[model samples]
Target: MSGHRAYTPSLRDRLTKAVMTAAGYLPGPLLRPVAGAPRRVDGQVLDPHFQAGLRVISLMSEGEYQDLTLERARSVVERSAYTVSGRKIDLAVVTDIVLPLGGADPDRADLPARLYSPVDGDEALPVLVYFHGGGWVLGSIDSHDATCRYIADTGRLKVISVDYRMAPEFLFPTAAEDALAAFRYVRDHAAELGVDPQRIAVGGDSAGGNLAAVVCQQTRDAGEKTPDFQLLFVPATNMSARTRSYELFGDGYFLTRGNMDWYERTYIRSDDDRLDPRASPLLATDFSGLPPAHVATGGFDPLRDEGEAYARRMADAGVKVSLRRHPTLVHPFVNAVGATPLAKAALSEAVGAMRMALAY
Candidate 1:
C-alpha cells in the first residue's frame, strides 16, 4: 500500500475549474445572476449558501491559495472577502490603532489592530479580542472585516480584530507573541477603550482560534488575568494533521490537507516548532483554571478533530467547555454567515454563549 499523496483533481474537477475560470472573465452583470445549489462532495452535503459562496471562490482561482506567493494569495483573499463579505461598515465606531509588540525588542514596532464597538453606548462594554485566520499566513483585519462586524452586532459586544504578523515574514512564535501583547495592551488600556477590562474575552476562527487558545494557556501559565471566555470557530488546535478528521475530510472540502500542510510548513521555522505548546495548545500539559471555552467545529473540516479534541481535553482537565460540531458544514463557515442561515445560526449560537459567559 502507498501513503497519501497530494490531491489530484479528477477530469470533472478540471472541467469545473476551467468553466469557473472562464466565468470569471464575464462582465460583472453576467456573473452577478449566477447561483450555486447544495451539492455533496464525497458524502457530506454542503450548505446551499456556503455552496454559492464556493462558486464565487471557484471563479477566482483553481486549487489552493497555498500555491500562490504570499502577496498574490493575499490579494485574491482580499478581493474574495470584499465580494463575499460585502463592504466594510461605519457602524460600531470602527477605528484603526497600533498596539505595542511588547517583550524586550527595542526595534519591534507596534502591531496593527482594529476596534469595533456597538453603535452608541454610554457604558463600558465587554470586548472580544479577535484574530483573523489565514493559516497564519494570509489573513488580516481587512480580510475578516465582515465577520467581525457580524460578531460585534450579533454578540452586542465590542470587538478588537488584531493583525498579528504572519509567516515567511514572521514565523510561529511571532504571531503568538503578538496575540499576547495585544491582549495585554487591551487589558491594560481597557479604560481608555471604554471596555470593561475584566470582561474582555478572546476569540477567533481557524488560525485565529488557535492563537486564542494559546493566549489562554499563556495567560494561565503567567499568572495573569485570564480571558473571560473563549469563542473558537473551527480552530486548528494541533499542528500535526494526523487526526482521522484530517484524513476523511482533507481533500474535497474548502480547506485541503495539502493547503494545511503548506500553512504549517510556512508558519513553522523548523520541524520541532510543531511540538511547541504555544503553537499547538493541544500539546500543552495543563488546561486547568483556564477561562470557560466554546469551541465550534465543522464536520467536514480538516481541522475539526483537533478542535474537538482540545475541547475534550479541556473538559477532562476541569475547564468549562462547550463544543458544537456542524456535521454538514465545511471550514470557514463563520465567514459565510452573511449568505448562509446555517452559518449565521451557528455563529449566533457561539456569540450567545459568549454573551452568557461574559454577562454583558
Candidate 2:
C-alpha cells in the first residue's frame, strides 16, 4: 500500500483516447497483416475479421435481449446495424420522392422512396428498383441505405429504394403489389428519374429479394414488359421452410427457423396462402419469361437451399441465372460491410455483378 499509486479516472480516459487515436492512424498495409484473409475451417472459408466481429457482437448481445417481438427486435436490430455500419457515404446526388400508388383508386399518401446516383454521373443511366430485406416484417430503406449506396455507386446507376408495406399490417401480396407498383412507377417516369426505361432492373435482399422475384412473376402474368435483370440476396423463396438447409443452419445462424415460422404466420392469411405463388414463388408452376436473374446465398443461412432451388428453377425455365454462395457468411452479411472485411469483399463482388448486369 505504501508504494502503490492512486487510481485516476482522468488519466485513464486520456490514455484510452491516445491508444485509439494511434490505432486509427495506422497505415492500411500495416493493418492488413493483422486482418488476415479467409481460410478454410470445417468446410467453410471463414474470414478472421468476420469471426472476430461476430464474437464481439455475440458478447454484447445474445443475452438480456430474449424478447423477439416485432417492436423490441426491430429497435435492437436497427440500432445494432447503425452502430456496426458506422457512417453513410456521400453519393453524388441523393434525393427522396413519394411514389404514387397507382391502379383503380390511387393511394399517393402511402409509398415513400429514396433515390441514389453515383457521384461521377450526370446523364441518363440504368436504374434498379430495390426492396429492403427484413423477412417481410422488419427492415426499411434506412436500414439498407449503405447496401443501396454500394450498388448505385459501384454500378454507376440510379437506385430507387422502395418503402413497401410490410406484414401483419398489410399481409401477403401487399408487399409484392407495392414492388410491382414501384417498378411500374419508375418505368413510366424513367425520364424524370433520369434513367432509361429499357435499362431498368429489379433487386432486393431476403424478404425484399422475394418481392423482387414476385414482381417479375407478376409482370409476366400481367403481360407487361419484365425487368431487364433481377438480383436477389439470400431471399426467402419458399414459405414452407422444409429445405435441408433449414435443418442444418436454422438454429445457430442469424436467421432461425423459429423466426421464419413467426414471419410466415404473421404474413400469411391462411395455410392455403402458403401454397400461393404470390406468397411462395417457389411453388409457382411457371418460371418462364422472367428477367435474367442473380441469386446469392449465405451457406449458413436458413434460406440458402430454397434460394438456390429457385435459381435452379429459373435456369431450367430458360432464364439466365447466376448463383453465388458465400459458404462461411451468415444471413444479412451484406449489411455488415462496415464491421467485417469479408462482408465488404463479398459486397464488392455483388456490386460488381450488378454493374455487369445493368450494363453500366
Best by TM-score: 1
Q: Write the per-residue lDDT of candidate 1 for residues 69-151, one digit (tens) a residue.
A: 76777766655555545334456578877776644775354777888887676568899999888888887787788888888
User: Candidates' lDDT values, in order?
Assistant: 0.78, 0.75
RMSD of 1: 7.9
Q: Which candidate's lDDT is highest?
A: 1
* Model 2 poorest 10 in a row by lDDT: 1-10
lDDT of 1: 0.78
lDDT digits (tens) for residues 88-134 of candidate 2? 67898888777867545643224888899985455888888998888
- The TM-score measured for candidate 2 stands at 0.84
Clashes of 1: 0
Per-model TM against the reference: 0.86, 0.84
Worst 10 residues of 1 by lDDT: 1-10
